[model samples]
Target chain A: MTARDQVPDGAATVWQRAVRARERADREEQLADKHEAIATETRTELHFRMAYIHRTTAARHRVTADLLEAHAVRTAEWTRRGGPPPLFMTGVAEACDTASVAVTLIDADSNQLAAAASDEPARHAQDLEYALGEGPARDAVAALVPVAASGTALRARWPGYGPAIESLGIGRVVAVPLQVPGDCVGALAVFDPRSATTDITRFVWVADALTRSFILGRDAGDGLLGEIDHRPEVHQAAGMVSVQMGCHVSDALELVKARAFADSRTVGEVARDIVAGLLKLG
Target chain B: MTLQEQELAAVFAQLTGEAARDPLDTQALLAALVESSRRLFGARGAIVQYTPGGAAAIQTDGTDGALQALAADAVGWREGPGHDARTTGCALIDVDVATHPTQVRWPRWSPRVLALGHGRVTALPLFSKDGPAGSLVLFTAPGSLLDERALKLSRSLADIAGHTLSLQREVSESRVLAGQLEHALSSRVVVEQAKGILAARHELTLEAAFARLRRYARSRQRKVADVAREVIEGRIELPTD
Candidate 1:
C-alpha cells in the first residue's frame, strides 16, 4: 500500500471550510438587510457562535493533526530505511478506532456515487453493497439512525449482503446515516469496529459532522464533485452501452455493475475498458 | 383563544418574525425586549443591560435624561440590579427603593437611581448555556412595584430576549466558521490542481502524484500547498519514479 490513496486531512478541511464560507456569506447578506442596531447585535452573536464553532472544530482537527503527524514521522523514518509506508486512509480508519472503515456518498436514490475505504477489504465491502443495492448504509439511511449487526444478525438481516460480507471476513458492521434536516447524503460504514458501543457514538458524531457541516451544506448547491470520486467515465460508458444494447441508461449501468461483479473486478476497471472501446456491452 | 391569549400570541408572533428576519441582530432584540418589558409592566421606563462584546445598555422610551444617566452609571459603577442579576445569575428586585434594604447595597448607584424618581427596580438575568449573558432591568413609578401579572409578563419577555441572544450567537458563529472554511477550500483547490497537473505530466496516478508532492513538501519543511503551487507554476519539477 502506498500513501497516495489517502484523503488527507488538509483536503477534507479545505472542503469543509469552503462550505462554511458559503453559509457565512449568506448570513452576512441577511444581516445587511436588518436595522443598524439589529445588525450590531447580530454581529456580536455571530462572533460568539464563530468562537464556539472554531473551538470545537480546532479541537477535533488537533487530534487528527497529531495522528497524521505521527504517521508522517513513521513514514519518514521508514522512507529513510528505503521502505514504502502504509496508505493514508488507514489513519482515518484508526482514528475512528476501527480496523476497516468506508465512507460512501450516495445520491437521492441511495445509489453509491463515490466511496473511499481504509483497505481493499473495506472497499470490497462497499462495492458489494453498491452492486447489490442493499446493506447497512441503505438501512441506516432508511431509518436515519446507526445500524449495527454482528455475526449471525448481520447475515440474517442482509441475506445476500450478509453472507458476502462474512466471506470477506467482516463479521461485524456499523453504519451511521449522514443526514441534515430532511436530506440524507450517505452513510459511514465501519467493519469489525474495535468496540461496537463506543465506536457507534464516534461514528454517529463523524456522520453528523460530515452531514451538517461538510456534505449537506455543499450538496445544497451541487458542490460535491470536489470531494467525491465521481465516475464520469462510467456514466459515459453506461450511455454508450445503453445505445448499443437498446436499453435505458439505468439498465445499462446495472448490466455493467453485474458484469464487474461476475468478473470479480472493480467497476472502475471495467468502466475504463468500456470507455476505451476495448470492451462493449451487448 | 381569550382576548389576553390572542394579544399575547400576536406579540409572540411579532417577536418570532423579527428573530426569523435577522436572528443575530442582538441590539434589535434587546431594544424589542426593553420595549416589551416596559409595555407589559406599564413601567416608568425599561432598560436592558448586557455584556455583549462589552458592557452595553438600551432603554425604552419615557425615561427622562436623569434616569438614562443613572442606568448608564449603574452599569459603569457595576453596582445595580442589572449588575447583581448578572453576577448572581438570578432575578433581583429592589422594591420601594426609598426603604428597601438592598437600596443600601448600591451606596453610590441607588441614590442616583432613586433621584431619577424611580421607586422600584427589577433585574432578570439573561442566561446562556455557558454562563450569564447579561440582565434585563425595569424601572417602575416611584412608590410603586410591578403587579404579579406585570412581573410575569416582564419575565416572559426577558426569557424571549434570552432566546433571541442565544439564537443570534449561533448564527454569528456559523458565519465565521463558514468564512474560515472558504479560505481553507481555496488553498486546497490550488493544491489539488497542482496534483492533477503533476499526475498528467508524469503519467502517474493521482495518488502517486499526491505522495510525491507531500514527500517533497516534508523534505523542504514547507506546506504541501506551497510545493504544489511551485509545481503548478513550473518553477519546480518532480522526477518520474
Candidate 2:
C-alpha cells in the first residue's frame, strides 16, 4: 500500500489533535498566570515554584501543538500533490534543526521493538547500532537521560559503532530518552545536527511530546503513522538461529548481531539472507 | 499587599502547592481544600465531594462525627445543596437551612442540618475540563451569609482543586496507556521470534509454525505470548511429529 494510505487518520484528525493540544496549552498558560499573580501578592516560594511548573508544562504543550500543526500541514500538502507520505519524524527532525533523526522504541530490557527515521542516513545509523548492539540511542534508553558525543568521543564510547557512524560523515550525535512516569519507553537520536543544537532542552521537549501525544495518544493505534519499521526479519532470524543451534532466542539474537558485525552488513540484510537459506550461522 | 490579599495568597499557595505534588495525595488535597475554604469563608464546617475519573470520595475538615455522618448520608441521598450544586453545575449560596423553602426542598436533610446547629449553607461546583466533577459545601452559623467577595474566593479555590485533580487523573491514565503500548510491542516481537524458531526447527513455513504455537498454548490453557516467551527462553520444547 502507498505510504499516504497507511496513515491511520486523515488530515482532519491530525488537525483536531493539534487544536486539542493548543487548548491544553492555553489552559496551562492561564494556570501559570494565576500562580504567578498569587506569588507576586504573597511573595511565597511555593507559589513561584508552582508557577514555574505550570509554565514549563504550558511550553511543552505548545511545542506539541506546533509539531502536530506542522504534520497536519504536510499531510494536507501531500494529499493535494499526490506524493510520498509525510513522515512524523520529519517535523521532529526539523524542530531539532537537523535532517537526520531516528526514534527507537525499546522494550524494558532496552531491546529495539521498532524504529522510525526521517532519512536513509538516520535509518542506516540505527541499523549500524542494531547490528553492532551499541549506539547513542541504546545508551540514552539504558541511562534514561540525554546522551551526546562528537568526533573521537563517539568512537571512544562505542568502539565498533562510533567509527562506523563517523565513516558516514556524521560528525556529532545526540539522543534523549522518551520517558513517561516511572518508565522509559524509547529514545530519539539526531545525527550530524547543527552545531550547539545539542543543548538538549528542546530535544527533551520534542521527546516528551512524542511520548505523550503521538505514541500514547488516543490515535496511537495507527502505530506511529505506519513509519515505524519493526525489523521483523531480524527477530525471525534470531528465532531460526536459536532453533538451529539449540540455544535461547536472546543468545541467538546476540549471535545474529555478531554475524552481521563480522560480515560488515546490516542485521536486516543478514536476517533476510538467513531467512531465505542463503546464509547460515552456528 | 493588603492583609486580606496576603491571606488569599497563602490559601492560593497552599492549594497550588498540594496540587503540584508528585504522585498527588488525593486525601491531602481534599483536606487542604476543606481547611482553606472553611477558614476563608468563616464557615463552621466544610465538606468536599470529589469524583475524579470515576472514583468518588467525600472528605470533611475534622468535623464532629454526627456532622460527618450526615454529610456522607447527604451524598448517598442526593438531597442536599451539595448534591444540587454538583448535578446542576451551579452554586447555591446563602441557603438558610431553617427557612421553610429550604425545608421543603430538602425535606430529610434540612431539619437534620438545623439540628446540627448550622443555619446557612453554600454549595460551589467543582469544575473540571469535562464538566462538574464534584462540589464543595460550607456550613455556617445562624444568620450568617457570605457576601459576593467570599463566594468568588470560594469558587476560585474549588476551580483550582478540580483542575488539579483532573490533571492528575489524566497523567496517571497516560502512564498506564504508555506501559500497555510498550508491553504489546514487546510481546509481538517475542511471538514473531518464536515463530521463526518453530519454523526453523520443524522445517515448516512460518504460518505453520504459528499454528503449532497457538495449538500448544491452547492445550495448556495459556496465553499465546506466554507460550511464545517460553519458547524463546528455551523453557518449553515442542516435539517434532
Candidate 3:
C-alpha cells in the first residue's frame, strides 16, 4: 500500500506536529542557555533562576518532540514494511529491546482500564493478567516498584498466573510501575525481552518516558485517548453481571475474571460474551 | 488575633506559598510585600525599588500625598535612605529627618524628607543571592522608630520579597519556552503530513518525498512547515525536478 493509504492522515499529522515541536523546543532551549550564560557572568540569582526555568521548559519541549519524532519514524517504517496496524506502545517495546511489550493504565482500584500492546502475544499476556487479576503489572502497581520474574520464579510467585503465562511460551517477564507525584498510574510490561540482562532500570525509563512525554504531554490530547484500549465492553459486561448476580460492580468484575480464568479464555472474550448476552452468571 | 495582625499573617502566608511554588509571580508578590510591611509596621506607605531594572512600585495604606511625593523624589533625585541602602547593601534609618546627617549627605533630597512631614524613614536592602537586588522603604510618623520587633519582621519581609522576585522571573521565562515548543511541534506535524501525502500520491518513498518538500521549501525561501501545510491543503505543488 502507498504511504498515505497505509498511514492515516490523523496519525501522520500527530507525528509531524511532534517533530516541529521538538525543533522549536531545541531552539528555545539554546536561547535559554545564552541567557543563563549571561546571568552566570553577572552572578545574579534572579537572572539565573529565570534562565534555569527557561532551560527546564525547553527540555520538556525537547522530550515531547523527541517522542513524536520516534512515533513518526515508527509509523513511517511500519507503513513501508506493510506491517500490522501501528500502536504507540510499539515504540516502548522497541525501547525496551523487546518485540513484545505492553503499556497498561490502571484505575484507582488497580484495575487495568486501558492498555496498548506491541503485538498479539503481548496483548494476550496483559489480557491474561486482567483475566486472572494477578500478574506483574498488578503486583508492580501494588508494591510501587519494579518486578521481574523469569521462568520458574514467575510460576512460584503467581501459581495460576505463572503456569498460564508459561503456556504462551513466554519464559520471562518484567514490569515497572509508572508513577507521578502522589500517584502510581500503571505499569509497563516487557515479555521475553531479547536483551538477556534483565535491566529493571530500562523498564523504568520507558515507563517514565511514556508517563511524562506521551501520556501526560500535549500529544495525548483528546484524539490519542481513543488509541488506548479502553475496554468499555468489559465494563459493560461487568455491569450486566452485577445486575444479574445482585453483586457490587467490583464483585461483578471479579466474577468476570473468575469465569475467564475457569474457561481459559481471555477476560475480553468472556466480557464480550457476557455483553453479547451469550453468557450468564448468578 | 487583632485585625492588623491577622492581615499580616495572611500576607506572609501568601508570599511564602508563592515562593515555595515553581513559578514566582514577581509583580503580585512585590505588591503584597509592600502592603503587608506597610500594615504590619503601621507605616504610612511602602515603596519597592528594583535593583536591576530601576523600576519602583509603591503601595500605600491610605492617601498619603507626602509619601507619594517622597517616593517620586527618591526615584527622580536618585538619593535617599532607599538609594543609599541599595548602594551600601545595608539598612538605613533616618529617625529625625530635620537634623539627621542624611540631610548633609543627601543635601538635595534629605531636607525634602522633613518637608514631606515624615518623622522617620527606614530602608531595608532587598538582598538577593549575591547582593542587594533592591530596597524596601517604610515611611513612619516622626519620632516613631520601628521597634526592635517591627524592624526584625520588616527585614524578613524584604528577604522574602527578594526571593519571590527571583522565582517570578524563572516562572515567566519557562512559560515562554513552553509556548515556543508548542508552536514548533504543531508546525512540524503539518510538514510530516504533507510528506506522507506526497509519498502516497507519487508512489515515492517517504524520504524522497520529504527531501522534495525540503527542496521546495528552500527554493521558495519559506519554512518547510509552511510549505508542507500548503501541500496538505492542496494550496501549492512542488516542482517535479
Which candidate number maximizes lDDT?
A: 2
- Expressed as tens digits, the lDDT of each residue in B1-241 for candidate 3 is 4454355457657875765555444656666777788877788777766643335453221225565566567767778777777767898864566675757877876677666666677888886534677788887777775577567556656755665665454344444533443345445445545654565456565578789989988988998978876775567767786
The residue-by-residue lDDT of candidate 2 on B1-241, one tens digit each, is: 5454466668767765665677767777777778778887778988777677355565433245776677688877888888888778999988888989899899999988888888999999887767887788889999975667767667766766776777666666777887787778888889889999989988988889889999998888999999999888778897665
List the TM values for chain B, per candidate. Answer: 0.72, 0.88, 0.72
Error of 1 at A151 (Å): 1.3
* lDDT per residue as tens, model 2, A1-282: 255557645677788888988998998898789878977875755457657877887888888888878888988888888767788888889888899999998877787888999998998899899877799999998888899999889899999899999888898999999987666888999888786645689899988888877787665535363778878888899999988888888888899989988888888999999988898997
Worst 10 residues of 3 chain A by lDDT: A1-10
lDDT (10s digit) by residue, model 1, range A1-282 = 224433233434444544544444444333333323432453434334334443444443343343344445544555556554444446557767887877777655666666667788888898888777789988998898999999899878998789988988998998998764345667889888776566466666556555544443433222222334455555545645654675655677788788887787767678778766689766
DockQ (C-alpha based) per candidate is 0.03, 0.54, 0.03
lDDT of 2: 0.81
> Weakest 10 consecutive residues, lDDT, candidate 1 chain B?
B53-62
> Which of the two, 1 or 3, has more lDDT?
3
Error of 1 at A47 (Å): 22
| Model 1 chain A: ten consecutive residues of lowest lDDT | A218-227
* TM-score order of candidates, top first: 2, 3, 1
Give the CA lDDT, 0 to 100, for residue A21 in model 2. 84
Q: How much of the real interface does each model capture, measured as fnat?
A: 0.00, 0.75, 0.00
Q: How close is candidate 1 to the true structure, as a TM-score?
A: 0.50
What docking tier does model 1 reach?
incorrect
Model 1 residue B179 CA deviation in Å:
17
Tens-place lDDT digits, model 1, residues B1-241: 4333344445555565565564345656666666666767778777767664443443322244665566677767888778788778899764566775766788887787677777788888886535677787788877674477667556655654665666565455554544444344434544655555555456565667789888888888999977866765557886665
